[model samples]
Target: MFVIDVIPFARFAPAGALSYRFNEYVLPGTIVSVPLRKKTVPGIVVACTSVRDAKESIKTAPFVLRSGAVTTTGILPKSYRIALTKTATYHLLPMGVILREMIPEAFLTHGFPKKLFAGTGHSLSFCEKTYTLRIEEYKKIISCTKGTVLIVVPTAVEIDRFADTFPSAIVVTGALTQKKRLASLKKIKDADIIITTPKYSFIPIPHLAHIIIERESANSYLTVARSPIDTRIAINALAHERSMQTTIGDYPLRMEIRPKPGSALKSISASPIKIFDVRKKITQAPFKALPEQILSIIKSTHEQHGRSAIFAVRRGYASTVICRDCGTSVRTTDGRPLSLITVAGKRVFRSSNGDTVIDAKALCDKCGSWNLIPIGVGVERIAEAVRNNFPNAPLVLFDTNTIRTPRDARSASTKFDIPGTIIVGTEALIPWLNPSNPISLAVVASADSLLALPFWRTRERLARLAFSLTERAEKVAVVTRRPDDAIFTTLENRLDNAFFKEEDSMRKQLNYPPYGHIVTIRIESSITKIEKDTALVQSMLKPKTGIEIPDRYATQNKVVRTIVYKYIDIQKWSDEAQELSQKIYRLPPNITVRIDPESLW
Candidate 1:
């Protein structure tokens, strides 16, 4: 029987190299059931090999393999596989976990893909908001008049709105359920018009057509977990394989050019990134800052035949619980707040099974008062605040707590049937860029909250957010105590094009990614002390490679630290990365290590 290398479908579990033998004839990229924990779970077949490193004493030695019947299930293109390996190695995550995101979950399984509009596609003769024909957009479809058209956008908001305009297209996104997702993917292969998120383009299409990125520079296009797989790289792959030229707005081009020359050179025309700075509007809002600026703006904007949105960072109602007598937030050791609930019109405990409510028997550590109040509003709290303030305006709440499904939410927003409503949400609000929705103004009440964080890439993100704000609305009011900070200075200067280069330089100098190589090793073996683990890592590396500690930690049995490798031996580095990752995999049960993490943001 042939042997197969399978990556079992488990995330964040104790990991080991998945080279063990399995059933027969399964091809690469095909999903199959493998033993995991108490039962069998499905996973993608990564490779086929006769190589076996396990001891002869093991019963499963020379494990048999099986070929998956899914259309001669295949490996990703060589380039994409290499990129995927680099990300998995760098992040120290299970290779399979990264692979799971490599292609979508659907095409690997039983169902067929679907097209966006298909038979009921809403044609776009004119812009929904402007009611004016965007003949500029139509030219591509009518002019090509041959190959199928694939229009990709950074967010579902754009996709939902844009897809309906086309008469027969399919919308593919993370929001679609597993069955529907596969249906959409299968059906869209031959579709004339296809709307999709960036990553899934790796799936083959029936024919090559013009590629369009609705708004290019969206942070959604960035690899939240890996750098090389960003939308820019995906487009390059398409161009290389299909000979189709990709189109992007001016925004994404600027970020990519500084990192690598000609990385973003698509012959292009773009609308200007318009800015409506409301720095002056906040001062004119009748107070140094309107305590309820978020709610008031929503009420006023909707009243004026325009829609408005409020953006906050988290879910749930109130963000913090504080003793009114003294300013101290109640929280847990894990950095999550100590949550509360009101049951049946009266106060109750957080969980029926755990912990005591209200420290009636205990004193407040800060003020000795039993009275506790919540501060720091979340998106839900802000929505309720809008309700309290507007009382009469039409309102729509969009957030994790309220919206059950992403597809439903995007579809709801796309309808444009409900006007004069406030869309209050978390990071969900980042994509609502309707150019002619009569959304004349926007208010970022806590825009600086994300900027003020201490993460490595805060400055770059701040600039991106500011640029996006300007592009999203005609008038924007950014609320912050320090309106004159350096980030804002860079953000406010429309003519300042140096932000990318300067920020890129800093990321490089610090040995952060896109500048150099990085890996975070989390050690969990009880027998090994923190210092011993550190030394073990140091001895594993060569004297020539630059390795430095960004941070080190130890809490008895738990130890973790990040190592930066700025100058790599390019010829052998990739191989070394794989070897080291394998060694990490075989480490004792107590150790935990994740390489390049999802957010240093």
Candidate 2:
């Protein structure tokens, strides 16, 4: 018999390794099943030793392996395993949770179809590359690199197109089925060139050399499902650990990542953004969702047999309905404002979660009065306005309500191929637009609406969106009440560098992320329990660390969210992160912790 230390791959468990007894020796990183609390659980072997000599060292080997069969033969290469640990600790998540993300379900359940070799040597060379000539850069990499090259994109929908662009590259993404994942895994084993999404980027390639992270600014890279992890940062860590060359490229490039000596930079000119100020007109005329100037642009485009798009921040018919007299929004039982929309020619009130539905004309839930009104226009409202204004034009809605799949989104964008078409959509439409079917005109329903969001990165997000829209279309117009806002002028002049500089300055002034780390501690339980837990967690903060409790609020679900910002020197970040994580872990299970959360709200 042999004693092995393994970490169980179970959710909601403490971050501790357990020892198990096995008849045969198992390799570190091997996936095996062991008994745990009257049930069998899968675990990764960290270390193993023969029982004859190790039994004295290990007394409480609580469980024994059922069989000597290794469920998964492929081991996480040592460097990748270290990267996973560092990421988990950095994100304040259980190591198993990060491993769960790195390894597919197929690998955990069944052994690899073929045994793989793990390379222990590193290249010992690191550098950064930036490129403005996207196609040319890809060609250069393809022609120069002899070893395996891994290319990671923002979404799985883009993988097919990228694979087509590089015909010799194999594709892998989270969207693949079980059979397809296995097939892709097999293909990746021998392929020197691969194109995949961030979901499958962790799989070890024996001859991996370079990693290219496209669209580095994409919000999709910052996954928030279980643990909020910046995939770009994780990929960069992996590349550094492997000593490989890395390139991160995006339009209106991210200013934070410093450019290395060997970098390809570009000078992009800005597009003039037209702003239509409507504050003076709203008081004189009835409230129109789209200003007359934007409407005229759309009409002119239609007259020219051109396509246009209207971008709205919200998705429903009416984002929320409110009481005019009481000033109270009509909320669901859970406290979320009810959205008003029409379905099958019948007006209805729907909850944000789509679980509750009521009559659109129902009295206010709070005041029981009939003086209710829609607060703002959503995609449906914009669609209605477009249809009424341009009666002869063909229009399609591409938001959460209409888009059920990526294919649907692609099909909607293809509709713009025909002239005189108007597409009403949310941010989902951004990725679907291309040069072949570009919109002749792009309209922002309200710049004020985007700027007023609770997120701290509102300015940065708005700047990026404005840049993207203006760059993608021949003309761009923003209908807003605040025409004098500097952001509008920045977009109008296409001064991306200036905008980012101001953004960085503001972030540094406020000590927000990329300047300092924000660790959020959250608790979800009965109201009383949450209150007590949050108070306890708050009391445990060290006063000397200069940790600022910026915001602490409770949600409708009785969950309390608390954010604490730490702006210490860069050299001490990792140490403090580990300390804070350990402190939070010591709290009751009712509480959870996240470092550098993707969303602060």
Identify the leading candidate in terms of lDDT: 2
Q: Residue 152 deviation, candidate 1, in Å? A: 4.0
RMSD (CA, angstroms), candidate 1: 8.1
Q: Highest TM-score among the candidates is held by which one?
A: 2
Cα lDDT of model 2 by residue, 1-601, tens digit:
7777777766544466777667777777777776666666777877788877876555554554444443444566666767776777677766655766666555555444343343244332221222225545767876787677888887755565577678888877767787887787777767878888776777657677778777677777877564467677677767767777776666555545534211222345434568788777335455678878788888888999988889988887778898988998898766666888877778799987787889888898888899888867789889989988988899989998889988787777668778888989888777677632347888889678778777776776776676677556888888888877666766666533455556667767776666677666666566657657656776767663323343333355565555455544656777876776666657776666666554664
- Please provide, for model 1 over 311-366, each residue's C-alpha lDDT reduced to its tens digit, 9 standing for 90 to 100: 66555444446776777765433222343433343433231122434422333445
Alpha carbon lDDT of each predicted model: 0.53, 0.69
Candidate 2: RMSD to truth: 4.9
Positional deviation of residue 570's Cα in model 1 after best superposition, in angstroms: 9.3
Estimate TM-scores for all models.
Answer: 0.67, 0.84
